[model samples]
Target: MTSDRARLREENEALRHQVATLRQELTCLEEQMSFLVNLCVASHRLHETADRRELLGILREILNNIVGSEELGIFELDAKRSVLSLVDSMGIDPAGFQSIALGAGVIGHTALTGKTFIAGDGAAPTGTGLEPGLTACIPLRCFGGDVWGVIAIFGMLPQKPALKPQDRELFALLERQAGLVLAMTRPD
Candidate 1:
């Protein structure tokens, strides 16, 4: 009878160890999930910028965080004239990006299609005058069915050949937030 009791105690101790290990793993997973959630929330908050100046800063941060890129530009579309006006941006030489026209480069293509474009090549199409590099562009559109701007991201090295599903998802999230802010601030 005493041997059976000892065996039962050992089994209970083993079960306790297993439970403890599982609890630790669960805690670690929860922490990871919490981190990802905070990133998404912070990304959304970036659009809270009150003016173009603030928005430009926020845009740079978002691209750096999400796309892992340091060089980026934001171009506003003048739909009436078919021109892409260089608005607020970061990590680029102004003299290199003046009066960049719509449909002139990857950003132009995104504006024209209202779809995101990703390029792995380090070359902007001929005649666009953009510096060669891997780039991605997301069209900016606001409520009431109006296209407002474009988000352009460039990297020193060639990017992956295709946009991953996660990349598209992030761009979509930024697009929605940017549209809301642009619509709110634009002349009504």
Candidate 2:
């Protein structure tokens, strides 16, 4: 009878451990689902927006609330001139680094190659003037395969110390949706 009782207690403890692990997995899934839903809603809103000002506001919200970054800049690309002109920015001053030439720096390289430039991946291009805190440069490419602009993310929020797959997904979404919206809203 004593041995049987000990075995029962051990089995009960194992079952409790399993339950706790399952609860943690469930919580992670729920958070992922919530992020996805918010992203979808933001994408829909971007598609529905017609005004350039309102679109910029929505972009700001996505950068701040969704991607968890406060310092960022959006630069519009002029292919003919091979230049990137700052159109909007937040948590960073846009005075000296307003315009970047193609192949000039990190932002310029991303603008030219249409590939992301992660800060920690390597040293930033010479003379890019990327702030010490800058972490990533995401090129905004339109659906037509043209690089429309670049979004320079300075740093992640303290709570988000490292970049995740979902963060990259959000960058891709911005590359497509924001590019299309900016192209549509550009004044001829």
Best by lDDT: 2
lDDT tens readout by residue for model 2, 16-100: 9999999999999999999899889878988888898889888988888887888899889998998999999988888957888
Q: For residues 1-188, could you state the per-residue lDDT of candidate 1 as single tens digits? A: 99999999999999999999999999988966765684586566666667756766776676676556777778778778888777766677756765666677667767777777667535544436564663678887788646688888766324543445566667877777786686566654
Give the clashing residue pairs of candidate 1, or none. Answer: 122-133
RMSD of each: 5.9, 1.6
lDDT accuracy of residue 121 in candidate 2: 77
Q: What is the RMSD, in Å, between candidate 2 and the native fold over all Cα?
A: 1.6
Worst 10 residues of 2 by lDDT: 123-132
